[model samples]
Target: MFVKLHFEEWIKNEPGVSENTKELIDEAIICYRAQAYRAAYLFSFLSFQNLLKERMLVASCPPGYDEEYWKGIQSELRNDDKWEAKIIECVERERPAQIFNLSVDTKRQYLYWKDRRNDCAHAKSNKIGVSHVESFWLFFESNLSKFGVGGGKEALLEKLKVFLNPAFTPVDSDPTSIIKEIPLTVDSADYLEVIENVYELTTVDIFGPMKTRVWDEMFKLRGEFLDQLVEFIKTNQSLYTQLLKEDPSKVRFFANDPAFIRSLWYEMKMDFRTYKVIIGLLRHNLIPREELNEMISTVSSNNNDTFFFQVEEPDLLVLEESGFFSEFKTLAFVDMKINDFNWARENRNIIWHLIIRNGFDETIVEALNNTMSNSFIPWRLRDSILELFEEFPKLKEEYIDVNSRINGCLPDKLFNSN
Candidate 1:
């Protein structure tokens, strides 16, 4: 039988999927068909969650994410302040001691990146050197090997197959592949039906053991990393909170606290928030760009020159009130749009290639998910996926089928596909 035909049959026995949720599955499939893996991945995951929530089987959170998961996110946010403090002192405010406290490696990368950024910003007539060309090629080469066109995770697995045991194949596809291939023509039923479906899907599911194992490993690592971060923040909260509470005008205090300064500097170099805040300050006219650079040069010179800004506790309060750091608390998702997912002139054709080649599997699913959240996806903006499923039906049925397969049971078809 054709793969699509098997999918349809599987859907016939799927239990618990609401019609509305089914629609989301269908839409994800359609997105897959249209070669919009980014949209497909996002929508599929959404459909899965909404379905479970409808059944009252799971909370309204992403798969593999729980209350602890959310708490961990909060921990990260608090720690984000340390990095913010560093950027404020070193880059935007040009506090010398802040720059000196940074690790040697960080200082090196920063200097290199800053020079390039400055040249571009000033529109300097800088000569493009051979090294520049080589850097560009190196980046392209690394990405090419990572996610080559028509090559998703499965492809990546194939390349790594040689080192595997007899029972392990690099190209082993996850049973979840079934979920990824849902067409874009189903609609979700009301919340009740959706929840029932999700619970049923979660139990007795069969995405090959190898595939499941790999996915499990990935999630395990992700959870562990998050746990480590949260623990670090909890342990260091006393120091960081104090720094954050201090006045930006009284930057000298940060220099006096040697241990705090060391930890704060390390956090700044690693956290994205510090850089983001610095960028935001420049973008929003909070600080003069030249003045910021001068601060960096000063910090570079002495690494502990804290007399630059006598920042006060009120200054820290002002920043917090401005939404400078606590922006990632809410999830921002929307229905997928072709225009939103496309990049450059060849996107349409690229979509065609991705779609016409047997629908999306795990690799394609990840690619689509990555694309949905690509840096180009915009800030404070989330891509919509729920609506996409409501726009499709056949795809939804396929999603239910996959879930049913995983559960080792028949899938339910709420709507007549005939």
Candidate 2:
């Protein structure tokens, strides 16, 4: 809820705060304010569960385990039916002595509040009063430092004062005031710092009207901003590479507008890294379908097969899901060479359905004919072609002559028949 603005960026930026946990806290705050005490208690308890799981994950894993490794642990915890037991097991095995540096009394209070939360969550007829909600808030307030809030309890109370008072004005409300101070022609490093600062200052209200004027202004300056960003990426290769390796989605703000994304795609020289950025944009639907098709067409026409294949290979499902059937067909048939038979066979199941669904039967027939006539085509691939024809009886009529020509031979005897 908008009232609890203090927790917005704090929860989002905390390494221990999973998105699910943040969402639970958001729901809990909304329900608590709405006087839906039972639902509020349940959501708060669920958030506590997530918090414990995150702590366990952090405490159990050694240092230098990358973001992806932590993500895997988080995902496993989410999917595990006995996650509570798993957390307990992790705590016992890992022996995490301290959690956010709470005093013993505060920890006891947290446990007591957790028990009350459980009672209200599990009992259908349990009545949760405002006292219980206030008690939980007290527990939460006492442990503010554990979640990485600075200035200790005084800062927590100060933020709470703003939450409780309607007329309280915060300096962060209009981030544009800060953004405007940064010159349009600032150096790349300074520009990146400004972008990061903007991201940190902006917060989305989960249950209220969207306020994105800061981001809107940034997007309006996409040409200048993206040019600087691309330059920064080029100049600072290691930092940019690290950001991508850790979390490529961090740069998704550039992909929020399709026209800007198209401009970015055109302005930057194509490379493996640029291709990955474009793929991330496409996955996020930041680039329009038509723009994506055009980009793919241009890449293929330029004989940039390596870039084309790199873009299409990992993102075939993304392309299909985005309904880029034309792009999918182009990637499937245009640049694919006979030497890529093993790659084709590896994804034959998905490719087969895609071909049939997109009405590329004629293309497959021609490819099969070419494969059969060309002696340079591997015998194993020749057998694969026959298998494809047999799988689709409708294509049998078209490829019957080619199949007969490659039917019985010394090669057929050497290789197993499909």
- Estimate the TM-score of every prediction: 0.15, 0.32
Q: Name model 2 segments beyond 4 Å from true.
A: 1-251, 301-303, 308-314, 323-325, 328-360, 363-418
Specify the poorest-scoring 10-residue window by lDDT in model 1.
325-334
Clashing residue pairs, backbone N/CA/C < 3 A, model 2: none
Per-residue lDDT tens digits for candidate 1, residues 46-113, read: 45434323322211122234557534433433463443233223322222222112345534543453
lDDT of each residue in 1-418, candidate 2, tens digit only: 2554444444554333467788898898788778898888778767766676654444323333455765665567776697765543433332222223345565667667666776885784667877777666555534533532122233323333343233665434543432332321132234566554433333223112112434443444443455565554445444444344334454565444455556545655555455565556657777665567677555433322234333345565665677655564655566554435544443344344454454334455455445445546545545544565567766544445444555522233212354
lDDT comparing candidate 2 with the true structure: 0.50
- Native-to-model Cα distance after best TM-score fit, residue 102 in candidate 1, in Å: 42
Off by over 4 Å in 1: 1-5, 57-418
